[model samples]
Target chain A: MVVRKYFKIYLRFLSRNIQSSMEYKVDFLLGILANLFQSILGLIFIWAIFNRIPTIKGWNFHEVAFVYGFAIIPSGISELFLNNVWLIPTVYVNQGNLDRILTKPLNPLFHIIADGFEPHGFGFIIFGASLCVYSTLKLGLSFSFLNILYFMVMITSGTIIYFSINLFMATLSFWLMDIVSSMVLVHHLSEFAKYPLIIYHKAVQIILTWVIPYAFTSFFPAIFLLKKGALMLSFLTPAVAISVFLIAYSFWNFGLKRYQSSGS
Target chain B: MVLKSKIKKYLALSKINIQRALTYRISFLTSLLAALIQLFVMFYIWKAAFSEKITLAGFTYSDMLTYLFVSQGINNIYGWYTTVERNIAYKIRTGDIALDLVKPLRFNFARFFEVLGISFVQVFFIIIIFTVFKILVPEFRTPKSDLYLFLFLVSTFLGFLCMFSLSFLVGLMSFWTLNYWGLYYVKKSIFDFFSGAIIPLQFLPLSIQKIAVILPFKSIVFIPTLIYLGKFTIHESIFQILFQALWATALWISAVLMFKLAIRKVVIHGG
Candidate 1:
């Protein structure tokens, strides 16, 4: 009953967000264009890299593209659904706007997440999904019906993992007041996951896997797709996603309780 | 003299920007740290790419490493610190450009000086960090010769001029366009490619290389970094320095012309 009620509210807010975004058709279209152009440029760079060398570490061009596409799916989903978390440090916490949010009857976290719908995310999703299909075909791989079901579930879990990290970063703003740099730092750290995890040093691999766990979202899923022999460890993605989400969610709750608005 | 006072005025603006670099504390530091992380990723990616071969695309392992660091270092020193496009766009949107226009100062020169001040700090930090890396990490390398290093320094200053002029040129579009962001965003991606900030220009196919050569973008990172590597002959280095100066002057003049053209259409709405 509670889930259904929240779902309805989320749908209403989403429609309102889209309506407002649609009001500025040029701005909206330009944003999508910008996003698409950036991704395509990144693709060209990857192509240039492959032109120089056949593979990086044991990963071929197709595999790397697969990993890149997998990374984009989760990132795009988080961007579409909950990008407002990125503004927490600079906008809400510093401006004492949390009080206004606190007055709302709905859970502030849900409200924040549901209110955002970046049209640019459609660019990411479309590009990523096509890239995934293109590369898979290039590599002569095919997903069975069951594997397709698994793919959808894993993509959701990957998005959840991304959401957890973003929420965790935003939650830091409650205590630190301004965490733009830290956010940038983590953002760069995630960029490392664009490649196969094995390409990095052991230390980087360990950090990305255990500490930040971005590898589970991007690399492990790609591995599951590439090597259909089913590396059982890839199944750990959902569990990792859930654990990080709960931790980040709890941290948000704790931070909310302790949030002292910048009333001055 | 009037010229002397104008130099002093710009210098003072530069000084103020250096002081303001730390006004937000963690913002600057973490952004630097983020750049470091990006460099780290590139380092590993290149290392992995080079594992099987001594050289790919005319760059040995060490040469490639040096290219990556020097290019990234140059970028870290001068890039994006000039948030000129967004600032101009916002000011134009909110009609704040009128206030700036009435001021005694030329806003373009002021913005340049401000960016130069931050670049000074950035150069300082980059030197210190690179020196530390060279001392501690055996993999890191320096310029092949002192003359090459000096030439690189000269080239870098000109490159900074080119970058600022190019960015300011784009920022001028704000006077005419309501959605200046898309243009700037597109420009950034294109800049990253043509500038050789992502990969060396030589790595590009011959056709693309021919095209990228004509653009001013390569002067920003490609020439200075290649000079540091002593990849060009002494005569070629001199030629590159002259080329960069030409680009800098041309771009700066064009930007001024763009401003003159754009200012005529300035309709600042909804202050």
Candidate 2:
């Protein structure tokens, strides 16, 4: 019953944001087109990297494309859903704007996260899906029902993990006073997950796997989907997603308790 | 004597802006950390690419590795200049540009100097950090020669002017389109592809090379990088720096004209 109520409220937010976006038709189209250009530029970067080489350490172009394509989908979903997290440090915590959110009956974090509905993220999702199809065709893999199920499950967990990371990072704004820098820091960190993990050093691989675990979002599951035999480890993504969100939730609560409102 | 005092006012504005930009010391540290991690990512990828091959295009494995870190460092000469977009966009949005324009100060010079102020702080930090990396890492390279270093500095300054002019023009677009998100990304995507920030234009395919010829973005990174790498002779380096100066002048003129036109069109919306 509670979930249904929240769902209705979120739908209202979706419609309102869409309405505002539609009010500026040119701006709306340009926004999606800009996202399309950025994602396409990313693909070009991969192509440039591969242009001078036959393989990257044993991985072919299509396999890397498959992984890169897989990585952006979850990122896009989280971007579409929780785009407001980007504003938290600069606006909410720093300027004492959280007071309004705190006064609301709904969960403040949920309100903040769900308030933003970016149609720009659709560019990434649509492009990434098509890239996946192209690569899958090149690899000659059958997209059977079980395989499709696994992709859906893993993609869903990956989105949750992306949201959890953004939530956990935004929660740091409550304590750190200004997390915009660290926010950008982690934004760049996500780019590292687009490629295979073995190419990186032991330290980076370790940090991506354990400390931040963004590798689980794209790299591990991608390798598993490619039948590269990290089968048991890739299965851990859903568990990792749940635990990470729980920890972030508790941490957010802890910070909320310490949230002494900033003043002018 | 009157002009001297006017110059003093702009310098004081720069001083104040520098102080304002430096208050986020925690931010400085985190941005530095971010730069280092990006360097690591580039290092590993290029390292992997070069594993089975000694060179890509004309770059040796070491040349490629060094180019990655150095180009990124030089590109970030405008690290804090990213704020210029946000500042100008906000000013135009809130109708603050009118107040700013009416001031005795020339508005464009003020905005340009504001870039100088923040980037002055940034240059120091970026230099120190890159220096630290050079000492710690064997692969981090120095300029090819003292002459090349001088030429690199000349080229980079001209490049900075060109970039700042383009940025101001992009920000001016807010007069017509109130939202800044799409504009910022569009500008960034252009620069990312054309500026040689991601990869050298020489390494890219011929089609991209043909496109890079028409875009001024390559002057901002590729020319300065090649100058520092001593890839060009003295005659060629001089020609490249002159080309950068030409672009810099052209872009500034365009920005000024656009700013004039855009200012008249600014109507505070929903008022």
Candidate 3:
């Protein structure tokens, strides 16, 4: 019942934001166009990188794009659904808006995350799905019902892991006073996951795989879908995601204990 | 006497703006640190590529680093946002430009000087810190010669003009659509990619490189970096500089004309 209530509230919140955005017809149109250009540039960057090199650690351009494209869906949706998560910690700290959020009946974190949904992120979803179609066609992969189940399960797990990592970083604001620098660092670190982990040195690859597990967000998912890794590794996706979430949840709870609201 | 008075007011406004801009110390520091981290990341990527004992593109590891460092330097120089254009659009749309026009100075000149003054200060701090860090860091590549240095500066000046013109055009679009952010984003993405801010243009195909050369965006970073790397002959450097000058002049003229057209069409509602 509580989950349903939250869902309804989230839908209402998203609808209101869309309406607000639509009020400025120019901004809405321009924003959509701008997002399209950025997405195009990102796609071109990946294409250019792959063109220069035949294969990066045995993954070709299409394969890399497959990972990037799949990962974009969740990340883009996260930006749409949880775009507020990107701004809330900073703006709340600066504007003292966290006080209002805290007063709300809904969980403050959930409420904050639901703010600022960029409806334009839906474009990324379309582009990503197209890439998925292309990659599957190129690889000539036959999909069974079990494969469909595995893909859905792994994609959900990947999204959870990605969100948890960002949330864990945002939670640092409770103590750090400013997590913007840390946010930049997190962004830079995650940029490495755009490519195959094996491209790095053995030690670096190990760190990405074992230490941060950013690879699980994209590389592991693509690998599972493509049947590159052992069947067991594919099954390990949900387990790893759940563990990361649990770990990050602990950190968030710990930080909340020290939440000294900046009374602006 | 009027020109002299306008110039004085411009300088004063610029100083005030720069001082105000410097107050954002945290943003400046974070951006500088981010740029340095970005430079280091590019360095490592090149290092890994070279380690494979294979030459993928025409560039060696050191060449790539040098190219990227020069690009970073140029990026610092042309880093001004079209605050004037955006703010002007906002002002004009809301009739705030009337207040600005009634001020003792020429509205256009004042806005230009104010933004330039602010950017100059921001760029100064960034350059000083970047230069100091580059000096201290063993890995950072320094531009080879004084001539190369001069060309880089000249090209960067041209870059400033290009961006200024772009923001001017985008801002003027507000007269018709009354929206500038979308235009700003589009211009930013193009400049970021074609200007070789994010990735080296050399990594791209020949056709793309050919197209990029004629585009004013390359004058911002790629041409200057090429000069710094000694990839171009002195004659070629002169040619690039000439092209930059031509582009700058063209953009300056375009900005002036666009402003006139925009002003004629502008339907200022109210304050």
Candidate 4:
């Protein structure tokens, strides 16, 4: 019953944000177009590199594109729903807006996650989904019911992982008010997910898998879908995603307790 | 005497900018760390690409690595400063730009000096980091000659001018538009793709390469890195430097003209 109430509230918030965004229709459209252009540009970068060489680490162009597309979909989903998590550090902690949020009856976390519903994120979803479908068809991968189910699970897990990482970084702002740099560092590191994980050094691969776990967000899932090796690790993506989210959530709460309003 | 006084004024403004940058040292350190990670990622990608062959697309492994390192290093030295762009846009949106317009200093030049001050600090740290990487990684290579190095530095200065002018124009767009966030992303995507920061222009399609050569974006990253890698002969390096200068001058004039037009349309919407 409580979940339904929150869902209704979230829907209302989404409608309001959409209405406001629509008031500036050109800006909204341009924002989406820009995101689409960026997504296409990233794919073109991969394509240019592949044009020079037939393969890298035994991963062909289509295979790498598949991974890139899969990675983007989850990132897009997270950006759609949880981009506000990124602003926590700057808006809530540094700027002391958390005090106002704390006074509200709604759950602060939910409020933060749902308040800023960017319609531009749909551009990422459209581009990503189309790329994924095209790549899957081009690769001639036959999908069973189980395969489709697994794909859904993997995307969900990937979105959670992306949100968890952003939340964990934002949580750090409670102590380190200027955490934007750390966010940028993590963002740059995550760019490796656009390529096949095998291309990186083993140390980097290991770090991406275990420490940062960006590998699971796309690499492992892509390999699983491709029926490549590392079956055991690929199957562990959901578990890793869940654990990371839990840890990040607990950390956020812990940080919240420590957050003394700047009182500006 | 007027020229000397103007120089002193800019120097003092730059000093203040440098001090402000130091106060936000963590931001610089993080950005440097981000650049290092990018370098490492690109290094591994190229290493894997070169595993089976010594050369691809005219770039040997050493050449590719050097190009990657130098491009990223140059980018760190003078690439996008989002803070500056945001400051300019925010001031314009909030009507604070009127105060800036009334100042005696030319707005564009003042902003350039301030950005240059920050870039000076960035280049210092990047040099130290690159020096360490060179010692630690035997694969790293430097320019073949002191003359090439001299030309590379000159190209880099031109590159900085090109980048600043582009950013200034983007900021000036705020005078006409209520929001420029989308424009900023669009500009960034174009710059990243055409500037050869993500991939060398040679690796791109012939048509795209032709387009890139004509665009100012390549002057910001591709030219200096190519010069550093000795991909260009002495004659070609001279030509490329001249091209960069041409683009820089053209962009500066366009930016100044756009700013003049934009100022007329500037409507302080609210307090």
lDDT per residue as tens, model 2, B1-271? 9999988888887787788768866776676677677677777888888887887888987677677877887777776344577689898777787798779988788888888887888788888887887788787678878999999999989988988998888888776676788888888788978999888898788987998966899888888988888788999999988889999999999988988777666643324
Which portions of model 3 miss their true places by more than 4 Å?
A90-94, A172-177, A201-213, A227-236, A247-264, B1-6, B36-57, B80-98, B121-144, B174-181, B198-203, B264-267
lDDT of 3 by residue, A21-119 (tens): 788877777777776677667667667766777665566677877876776766666656666655746887556687788788988777887677776
- lDDT (0-100) at residue A261 of candidate 2? 88
Runs in model 1 with CA error above 4 Å? A228-230, B176-183, B267-271
| DockQ of every predicted complex | 0.64, 0.64, 0.41, 0.64
Total clashes in model 3, counting residue pairs 3 or more apart in sequence or in different chains = 0
lDDT of 1 by residue, B142-162 (tens): 778899889988998888899
lDDT of 4 at B40: 81
Over A229-255, each residue of candidate 4 has an lDDT whose tens digit, in order, gives: 899988999999999999999999998
iRMS, model 2 (angstroms): 2.1
TM-score of each: 0.95, 0.93, 0.84, 0.94
The iRMS of the candidates, in order, is 2.2, 2.1, 3.5, 2.1
| Regions of candidate 4 where Cα sits further than 4 Å from its true position | A257-260, B82-84, B267-271
Predicted candidate 1, C-alpha RMSD: 2.1
* Candidate 4: tens digits of C-alpha lDDT, residues B1-271: 9999999898887898788778888886886788687678777778888896788889888888888888888877864443357568888878788888888889888888888888888888889988998998777798899999999999999998999898888887766556778777787788889999888988998988888889899999999999998889999999999999999999999988988878777643434
Q: List the residue pairs that clash in candidate 4.
A: none
